[model samples]
Target: MTNGGWFNHYDDPDEFWDDEPLPIERTPLNPSPSPSPPQNPSSPPQKVVPTPKPVEPQPWTTGPVSKSAGAERLQSGVGSSFVAVQVDAGLLPVHVQLSPQWHRHVDGSEAGAELMRAYQKAIGIYLGETIKSGKYFSGEFRHPSAPPDRRTVLMLLLETASWADYRETQTRIYARNGFEVHGQAQIQNEPVTSMRANWFQVKSIRIWPDWARRADPIQIVDEVLCCANRVRELRPTFKIRGDYSRYSDEDLEYQHLQHRENLIEELGV
Candidate 1:
C-alpha cells in the first residue's frame, strides 16, 4: 500500500492477523438422503410405459454404407484430415481419419504431395486395399518435434535420397550451420559408406513414410540440424571455408596479370 499509492488498511500490520480467530469445522447432522421433492399421493396411479429396446445395428455384411456418404462428407470441407490410417476393428472395417500435424506442415511443400502418396501407398502395402477387421498400423508414435540430432533420420534420408541431391542438400545444410561436408560429391558413385545397404532412390516416396507423416516441425528441424553437426564432426577432411575459398590461386593470378598487362599497354609510347 505504501508504494502503490493506496492507503494502508490498518495502521499496525501485526494487529490484523495476530488476533484473527480460526473458523470452526463443524459437521451438521441429518444429511438429506435424496434431493427429489416429495411426490403427491393424490395423483391417480400413472401408467408405467416400458422403455422400448433400441434397434440393433445391422452387421457390416448386411449394412454397407453408400459410396455417396463419403463423397458428401469430403465435399463439405469443414475440417482438415491430417491422419489417414488403415484400421481393422469392430464389425465394419474402416480407416480412422485424424488430422496429423505432418499434413499441416508439409501440405504446401513440394515434398508434401510426395509424402501423402507414400503414406497412401504404405497403407495399402501394410494393411491391404480394404481395411480388414483388425488393428493395423497405430499412429501412436510420439514423434519428436524435430528429428534427433543423432543423424539417424538424416542418414536414412540420405541413403534413399538421390546421391547428387542428397549430397548437395547435405552440403548446403552443413554450410548454413557454419561447417562443411567432405566427400559430398564422392558419395555419388562411391560404395555406400554411411549405411550398410542402399534401397532408397532419390526423392523416393518411401523414405520414412510414417515418420514424415507424424513428426512435428520442431522434431523435423532437430533431426536435420543434429545430423548435419554429427556429419561435420565425423568427417575431419571437411574444412571451414574462408571468404576467399571460392577463388583459386590461378584465378587470382590471372586477374592480377591482366590488370598489369592493361596498365602497361596504356602507358606504352
Candidate 2:
C-alpha cells in the first residue's frame, strides 16, 4: 500500500535504490611483467667435451734384452750374406763374408791331402758326366778365390745356378769320399762305382732351380751326341787323335811279344 516515485525498499537489507546506475571504481592497469624462464626440476647436468692430447713417438732402445728392461735391439741386414743348412747337423749355418779373414784356406795345415784327392776325383767324374750329359749348371759350382797353389784349391767354376744345387754338390763330394759297397759284383760295373756315384750327384745338383737355372741333363747329352755327329761328319772312320798310326802293326806286335816275355819271367812261369 506504499507508493514511491523511483525507489522502493522493504525487508531486504542489501537492495539497491536508485533511479540512475552507480559509477565503477578505476583499477590500476600495470602491464604483466615478462614471465621468468621456466625452471626444470629434472634437468640433466651439462656434458664437457674433452680436447685430445698430442702423442709423441717412442725412441729406439739400446739396452740389452731382459724382461726387466722391457726393451729390444732393432736388428737389420748390413749386406749380402749366405744361409747354409747343415745336411748332417740340421742346423742353419750363416756364412757371412763380411771380411777376407773369414775366408777359409784350402791348403792350410788343417787341410787333409787324402780328403783333397778324393774331392778332386769326385769333382772330375761328376763334372765330366755333366758335360757329357748336357745338363744345366747349379749356382753352387763357383771358384771361391783361388790361392797361389792352383793344385791345392782346384777351384772349378761353372755358370751360376741355385744356392740349393751348390749345397747338394758339396754334400755329394763328402759322401763319395767315404763311399763303400758290400757286394764285389759292383766292382766290374761299367763306368765304376766312383764314377756312377759322382755322376748321380751331378744330376741331382741340376734338379734345384731348374726354372731359374734352365738346366737339363738332356742338354749335356745333346751336346755330346752333336759333337760325336760332327766328329763323324769330319772323319767318318774312327782314327786316333795323336800320331799312333806312325807305328805299323808289325812294330806293335813286336812290343807286345817283348812285354809278354818280361811278364812270364817276372811270374816264373
Candidate 3:
C-alpha cells in the first residue's frame, strides 16, 4: 500500500490477461423450426383435391298427358275415301275428319245413313280392341259368344230394359234439379269472357272478341276444365225426392237388381 493510492493484488497481471477469451453460451430471441425429412424422388407427387360443395335436392312434378299419345284414330270402311275418327282412352270422340271424296261417292240423301254406318263400324272396332286387350269387363253382364237359352235371352232383355229405365230416371232427376253455375276467363288480370253451365253441359258462353283474339288456347282449355271439375263435384249433391232420396249409387243398383229378381220370380223364368 502507498500513501493515498490502491495497488493491484495479482502476482503477474500479464499472465492473467494473456489467456484467450472462453466461448460464450448464448440463446437467440427466435429459434428456426426443424426441417422436414426429404421425400423419395421416385414416388409420385400427391394430388391436392378441393373440398366438394353440398348438393340441393330437386322437387318432383307430373306433367299432363299429350293428346296424340292418349288418342286413337281409326278409318271407317264407308264411302270411297272413308271417314276417320279419333277417340280417347274412354272411347269419347275427340275428332272426326271426313274425306273430300265422301260427297263424291255418297249421295246427299244417304249421307246421314252412311255417316251412321261409319260410326257404328268405328265403335265396333274400338269395342273389339278393348275386349282383345282385356280392358273390358268379362263379368256376368258380358254378352254370350254363342246362342243363349230362352231364360238367358229373357234375362238379357230384362237387364237391358232395366238399365235403360235407370238411365231415363237419372236424366229426369237431373232435368228437375239442374242448377246453373257461372265461370269467368281472365286475360292480363282483366275479365275477358264468362261461361254458364247447366249441370254437366255448358249452356252458353260469351267471349269478348278483342280478348279472344289475344287469349291463349291452352289457358282457355284449362279454365274450362276447372269449371267442369267444379260441376262434377256437385253431381253427388243432386238427391232424388221421395223414397230414393237417401239412396247411394250402390243402393240404387241393388234396388234395380232386386226389382229384376222379383219380376223373374213372378214370371217363373
TM-score of each: 0.17, 0.15, 0.26
Tens-digit lDDT track of model 3 for 100-168: 555456454443344345444555566545544444444323322223443333333334345455455
lDDT of each: 0.35, 0.29, 0.44
Which one wins on lDDT?
A: 3
Highest TM-score against the true fold, candidate: 3
Q: lDDT at 77 for candidate 2?
A: 16
RMSD of each: 30.0, 35.9, 28.9
Candidate 3 TM-score, C-alpha based: 0.26
Segments of candidate 1 deviating more than 4 angstroms? 1-102, 105-207, 238-269
Predict model 2's lDDT versus the native: 0.29
Candidate 1 per-residue C-alpha lDDT over 1-269 given as tens digits, one digit per residue, 9 for 90 to 100: 42333333567643344343556788779766768776789987679999999875432222334222332332333222443433121111133333445556554333334333433443333332222322222333211222233233233223322445444644533432222222121223641111110111112211244544454544433333333334434331322232443556565556545644554455563
Arranged by TM-score, best first: 3, 1, 2
Residue 237, model 2: lDDT of 19
Model 3 misplaced regions, further than 4 Å: 1-81, 88-92, 138-269
- Locate the minimum summed-lDDT window of 10 residues in model 3: 59-68
Descending-lDDT candidate ranking: 3, 1, 2
